[model samples]
Target: MGPNVHIWRHSRCRGAGWALTSPRARSQAVPGTPRHPLVLTETAAVSLLNCLFLPRVAEAASLPSALPLSASWKELVAMWLPAGKASGRLMKNSSTSPLAEKQGQTSMEASSQSVQATSGYPSTSTSTSTECKPQVLPVIIPILLSILFVACLVLNSTSLWIFWFHIKRWNSSLILQFNLVLMDTLLIPIVPLMVTYFSLGNSWLFGQFLCQLKIFILSTHLYGSIYFLTLISIHRYLAVAHYSTRTLWKKKSFLKKLSLFVWFVLCIQGLPLFFVLKTSVLNGTVKCLSIHQSEFSSVYLYYSIFLVTISFLLPFGISLICYALLGAIIMKMSSTSLRGRVMKTKSLQLIMVSLAIFIICFVPLHVSRTVGVIVKYYNMSCKLLLQVEIAYYASWVFTLVNCCLNPLIYNFSSEKFNESFSKSLRKFRFFK
Candidate 1:
């Protein structure tokens, strides 16, 4: 039953008074026995084999001779031996034989290990590395990002078309919104790369130079976005708060120059990024940390404060104030004096709605991440895993939302935006 083993046995036949049956092959066959290889009756063969090979049977009978030898020993041995040997021959050593099994196991384990070691996410890999299969974001993140990227391109393309063709280019509000659309369009493509990188848990899948290039792009876009947003808010403030002010901050030429200055300043502000980001291994995964080491924490903090204040908080505050004031002024305007004044007021209301959405989407993420990063520096603990996970997922959703919201924001919130967009559509349809 276990494995094939060779068995050697002998048997004798004895008859008495023509009885053809005898208990001992003359067990008493000559009391002084020559130790012939033990003769076995069929029963004795099975029993002897079991006793020598099977401890249970052997333990039952202390003496081998104690086996009850049948009168027909020859027939019994003939019946069982061949069958048992054939069964042994047919037995699968692969499953039961220890040496054979161990070898097979070794082969299987090796195959599995090699498979796991091979390049992971065949969806992403140029070549297979089956031996070291670890779950990586490089394989998955790009996919999600690519999907969003395409969507952003399509949506923002519509906005861009409107900005280029339909916008009057004279109305300061229209000019302002057109610039905002242009800035947002420029910002969309960078997301896929960031998504790929973040998907790898902040690991920079792109090489060192590309890594720095990406960070530069990211910082520039961030600063640029804040710059344009602040400009949009300032434009609204001039139009609504200082209604009929002597100077036109809304003038197309001034707005163009302002946009150029914003780009220049953004490039300058993002330059220091080259010094901070470097490739490093985090928990055995390669990542781009803010610095080569914590020695630069102070510097990173200083930059972060500047960015959060000047780029995020200040722009957000200014936008809120501008919109709030516009809403108040629109309410105070003479409904009888102006045609469609209420509709124009509704545009300001739309801008307010868009501003609220932006705050709702991004503010929580910045707050939690800032807290966790600061707390982690002083006391790293498992308790923060929940907060980190929340911030991470929230940031992703927030970013994805930004991709599609620009056009809708203009269309729904700002009537001036809708007017610009509709005019562009009309020109394309009629002229082409």
Candidate 2:
């Protein structure tokens, strides 16, 4: 081939003509044979450009059909050619060699990009993952949990030591409070694990079995504490309000049997957790008890409802009634004597603290969790579901406060335990 023919063939192959030519130059580059082949008429160039770009643009932008020749050519000029010296440089480069190949490579790259976009490959997956998985739990959640973990560890440990060592005599009230202490103690170790999970942004490093076990222990502590508090309130109410039942309330045997029954019931209630509580991985992070609201099952909804009613609602009612009656009875009791006034004050303290636990801790958790389940089960809007989920998790974090507060129940339940605690505290310089 001759020099002009070689240059023309090279420029055509590299798509350099699209950038270099202009409407005013149409007469110079006319359709002709290869011997004089520095020629592509406007119609031929338009058809060639459409063939090169239409499929890619259509797929990328979801266009219905090819744009008109004038519109497409104008857009193509706008895309590849810059103004002033840049256009001159592009023309010079096309007339030469290497830059034309670069232009062709850039076109190939753009086509590849459109193909990638059409196939849904790049930004879509990342955006979806970010939208689906929560960014970070509320800052206060881990903070409060860490505080509770420390408080629960200290208070429950002290209470456990006092009950086991300092208090020589064990009455039914002390026994019941000791069981509450046991529940708190059992739950204390789990709190730090929970804090770690939240601190790591809701990742559960523990395996599936441990996840189920963690939830199981939490559930057990929750309902177990509720039942124990209810039993304490009932026993106190019967002892104070109904004099004949004082003998029954004082008997450790009856309380032990009742405690055993509570444990059995709690065990039965926890069985479902082994099935429902699972460790799931979301966007490569392992999660436990962090199930998305939309993924909840109908069966889980029903189970949650049943669990809340029996474990929370019933005991809550019974405890409320018991405390109300006990309060009334204590109020009516003669406070003329120092002993009577002190006894009344202690009883009042127990009533207030237990009520605080029920209201501040249990009620919000049960209400939020139940509402979350219902909203999820019915396939509600994600907005409402997310609000409920936030409420539920917030309540869950606050409910752990009960472990730290149960020691107050122990303190207020019996005068002997209080005396023993004071003696133990006095032995240390902190209480001095």
Task: Give the top-scoring candidate (TM-score).
Answer: 2
**Model 2 over residues 1-432: C-alpha lDDT tens digits?**
222223334544234354334444445454573432234554445544445544444444444333354554566566433432444554455555677567666665555454344334464334234243445678788898888788888888888888888888787887788888888888877787888898898888878888888889999999999999999998888777766554777899998888888889988899887777688777788888763624446777888888788878999999989888888888899999997898799899989999999999999988888887776566566677677767877897779889877878777778787888888877886756
**Candidate 1: worst-modelled 10 consecutive residues by lDDT:** 12-21
Q: Over 4 Å off in model 2, which ranges? A: 1-135, 244-246, 291-296, 430-432
lDDT of 1 at 57: 24
Off by over 4 Å in 1: 1-147, 198-203, 289-295, 334-343, 412-417, 423-432
lDDT of the candidates, in the order given: 0.57, 0.73
Task: Please write out the lDDT profile of model 1 over residues 76-169, one tens digit for every residue.
Answer: 4554446545445545332477786776556545433432333121233434322221233344445666777888788888877766655543
- Candidate achieving the largest lDDT: 2
Pairs of residues clashing in candidate 2: none
Q: Write down the TM-score for model 1.
A: 0.58
Q: Which run of 10 residues does model 2 get worst, by summed lDDT?
A: 1-10
